[model samples]
Target: MDLTGTQRAGATPTWYEDALAWACRPVHHTTDISPLRAHAQAVGHTDGYRPHPPHRTRRHP
Candidate 1:
């Protein structure tokens, strides 16, 4: 999926702003193990939760 950040034109849309805010939201570190991460760890025996690798995009001049 193409993130809204790079697709915006003049006068940013509310959805794009919301998505940007969500993406830039502060994250707090804690000892807590999210249920989803815990389940994944339990099933996959991973050391921790890892998100998918970033998507690569091409820039056209």
Candidate 2:
């Protein structure tokens, strides 16, 4: 998969996938990782951290 494309309309940033790959790589070797730790690793891979849309939370009625 190509990881060098610029963000297009209605598409996620390119770095997001790279970050995901980085995050998943460690899981293949280790089995006792926490989700929070994996998330942190993903975020760290995004160079300088690109501004992303805020995660939407479902409102309970």
Candidate 3:
């Protein structure tokens, strides 16, 4: 957690945990509400969102 410590200075950075010797669990992201927030900032399509997800935008037609 502390990058400023002396331990990291002389040695290569290692994984924070050992894979073979330990168990792991997923750390849940608290929120991903950027889309709603962005849409609100763009004022409900009156100003428009400039970039959309790539697959939504184009076709060979």
Candidate 4:
């Protein structure tokens, strides 16, 4: 049978016919949160150690 273009030899749909096919399957996705957590912790630590000035003054005469 000529399966080129819109030609179908049977009653099965295009997707149904390729149910067990892995070539058109969705890929597995994953995200790593360790780096983000480390950055947040570093920022928090720096914020606690730094002292804020009580007043602002012009240094230039």
Best model per TM-score: 1
Residues 1-61 of candidate 2 have per-residue lDDT tens digits of: 6433454454655756666655444343555442223333464453433233233347778
Ranking by TM-score: 1, 2, 3, 4
Of the two candidates 1 and 4, the one with more favorable TM-score, higher being better, is 1
The candidate, 1 or 3, that scores higher on lDDT is 1
Tens-place lDDT digits, model 3, residues 14-54: 54324211222222332332221223455445333223222
Per-residue lDDT tens digits for candidate 1, residues 1-61, read 6546556554455875455444444344533322222114465464533333343356778
Candidate 3 — which pairs collide? none
Q: What are the TM-scores, per candidate, against the unseen true structure? A: 0.26, 0.24, 0.17, 0.15
Model 2 residue runs over 4 Å out of place are 1-13, 27-61
Error of 2 at 21 (Å): 0.3
lDDT of 4 at 45: 54
Give lDDT for model 4. 0.35
The whole-model lDDT of each prediction reads 0.43, 0.44, 0.34, 0.35
Backbone atom clashes (below 3 Å) for every candidate: 0, 0, 0, 0
lDDT of 4 by residue, 1-61 (tens): 4465544555366654354333323333423211112212564452212222233345766
lDDT (C-alpha) at residue 60 in model 3: 71
Name the candidate that leads on lDDT: 2
**RMSD in Å for all candidates:** 15.8, 14.0, 16.6, 21.9
